[model samples]
Target: MYTISTKLKVILVLVGALCFSVTVALAQGPGFDEDVEDVPVPFDGGVTFITALAAGYGIKKIREHKEKTK
Candidate 1:
């Protein structure tokens, strides 16, 4: 079972990751979207990878924390 501090840390980490991703995305230069083509392919692989990376990092932290106390 996780202590309150552990839970809080996890939540804060997740929120920070979300904010970082949003800020980086907003800070990027404008892309070339000069076409109204039919069925536009939504390209969000970067976001997906970022999300996965964050999740993996979070899991690693949790596992390490658990191991450290044992």
Candidate 2:
């Protein structure tokens, strides 16, 4: 048997709500009844920026963890 902490229960509920909202919104789709033409999505620099930021954060956290273990 296992017991979940109050904090973890709250976090799980919030995540579940977020996922349900996203699913419902996606199912609703864009409101229009016309023939839509295929539009190409542009490659934005934001993707690269976010990737670099995440990589940097990950590296920093790994270094901190290694130091703490030492």
Candidate 3:
């Protein structure tokens, strides 16, 4: 049978706990009201910056892996 390492087990538990906590917090928060009008979310530069950073990091890792294999 396959076995999981302690580090992986701890990581999984922490992730599960975080997801559970977030779910509880969101459930307790204020919900939509029919009387109140919906507001549009403004475009944020931070999201674009993060997306670009992630894409660049992925490209860099892929290039590194290709070089290593060669």
Candidate 4:
């Protein structure tokens, strides 16, 4: 039988309660919606491709740095 200690149970319950509260707050919060104008900059296929490539390269560099530290 796996018995949970009082201290552990209390910590777990507190964490769960905190998470529930955060979720509820976010659910009721004002945020961007479908009606909002998400007007993207007018970019052709070449520009879009270049932007994606640059972003991917930046992400790859960050991941490599993180891996080296660990």
lDDT tens readout by residue for model 4, 1-70? 2355877888999999999999989898577887888889876899989999999999999999999999
lDDT of 1 at 27: 98
**Candidate 3: tens digits of C-alpha lDDT, residues 1-70:** 1356877888999999999999989888577788998889977999999999999999999999999999
* Candidate 2 accuracy as TM-score: 0.51
User: What C-alpha lDDT do the candidate models reach, one value each?
Assistant: 0.93, 0.90, 0.91, 0.90
Clashing pairs for predicted structure model 3, backbone only: none
**Per-residue error at 47 for model 2, in Å?**
1.3
What is the lDDT, from 0 to 100, of the residue 28 in candidate 1? 88
TM-scores for all predictions: 0.44, 0.51, 0.53, 0.39
Superposed Cα RMSD, model 3: 4.4
True-structure Cα RMSD, model 1? 11.1
Over 1-70, each residue of candidate 2 has an lDDT whose tens digit, in order, gives: 1356877888999999999999998998678667877789977999989999999999999999999999
RMSD over all Cα atoms, model 4: 8.5
TM-score, cand. 1: 0.44
Best by TM-score: 3
Question: Which sections of candidate 3 miss by over 4 Å?
Answer: 1-30
Candidate 3 or 2, higher TM-score:
3
